[model samples]
Target: MMLLDLFAVIAAAVLSVRGAPALTQDPQAAERPTAGVFVATDLNWGGDTLWIPDASNGSCIVLPAPFYQGTSSFGPDKGIACSLWYHDDCDSRNPSFGPLRTPGVSTQADWSNATYNPNSIDNNGIAPNSWDKQVTAFNCWNVGEDGLHID
Candidate 1:
């Protein structure tokens, strides 16, 4: 009986190990956005580079560089010092919405043109000017190769 129990345990362990790979690989199995999926930039002020994902709200998944906190036209410098200029979707109510669907690099200009720009900003340094200076997108993904997904 003890031997039979040991064999059952071993079989369970083997099955678990075999199943582990399937679970782990499931995310990759799904069609994921490739690297450099989208680009992000500031709209109101041209050349004010925006990262792909905004780390402030814990939404971004990638970025180009480690965002730095520096004083700028926006308020006190803190958090990932970049705009959340673009995303895959327009509606914030949905989790999967972002910029992937939108062709071309996501830019502040695109965000500014959106109807929902005003309510997106919290007056924080990162999203300082929702009315005048729009940053962030509804469905955008991060492109930072380093995997620095958050601020």
Candidate 2:
């Protein structure tokens, strides 16, 4: 996203939270900001949706309450991406959702390659290991290629 566009989104979000009307000539033309992960309460992408802003670099941010215990579905929007962990502090271990690459390594799938099916993800072959509705924490960063591994 462009600097001006990002600034506009931040300003608008602040205004909206402060109960101030947004500054726009046409209310219908103002697009909702799409610079973060979109988490839904219902499976198949339904029910309440929350837009979580990008986490500062290398920061281990915990998921918000209610969602901290479980999340039905989640997808990252353009410009920003992240990975979820079954435990707080971004630790993907046994019984935790992880990236699908190595045969049995605990890593999270990249945002661009997310399948959006927590249940299908390989956490293990058991209960909490199924990865369905089992997210406790996460890490996020702006999607960029420079100095970043695509895998």
Candidate 3:
């Protein structure tokens, strides 16, 4: 029927829109120019992007299956970085999730001060010897005023 054809067309359009780079933003962070986190599926900031809308206030986040170890970038600050761990270290926040590995961290592979911009502190997560394909759970915090990285 003609109605069925119209429904199919509408559905196709909606699906196409979903494929675009969607910014699932949080209104609180939207006010700040540099607030959320950007995790990409490939190095050099290429490929699919997973945006964490609330990286400024400190919290633990477990990367969904699509973004595991893909690589990450913080808000527009060279000093801002996320503490990345190889296994699921967010047990309290994510009680149901199991560790992807043995639930530990390799300092060489897990970068605590991981920034997209390569710096002297080994901040780059996408580097050859960094957390490129190994990150699972990460802790994000405000730039300063922090006793702990994640809360």
Stretches > 4 Å off in candidate 1: 1-36, 40-59, 66-100, 104-111, 115-117, 125-151
- TM-score for candidate 2, please give it: 0.50
Number of colliding residue pairs in model 3: 0
TM-score of 1: 0.25
Instruction: Indicate which candidate wins on lDDT.
Output: 2
| Residue 84 accuracy (lDDT) in model 3 | 56
Q: Write the per-residue lDDT of candidate 1 for residues 79-142, one digit (tens) a residue.
A: 2223333332333432221222223323445433433334543323333223232223322334
lDDT of model 1 at residue 5?
A: 100
Give the TM-scores of the predictions, in the order they appear.
0.25, 0.50, 0.46
Give one digit per residue, the lDDT tens place, for model 2 in 66-96. Answer: 5675566665444445666765756544333
Error of model 2, residue 18, in angstroms: 18
Worst 10 residues of 1 by lDDT: 68-77
Backbone clash numbers for all candidates listed: 20, 4, 0
- Candidate 2 Cα misplacement greater than 4 A, ranges: 1-34, 92-129, 145-151
Q: Please give, for residues 1-151, the per-residue lDDT of candidate 3 as tens digits.
A: 9999999899889656544243333212333455555665554344565556565454667777567755543222222345555556643322121121111222333334333333223322344345445667766554433333333
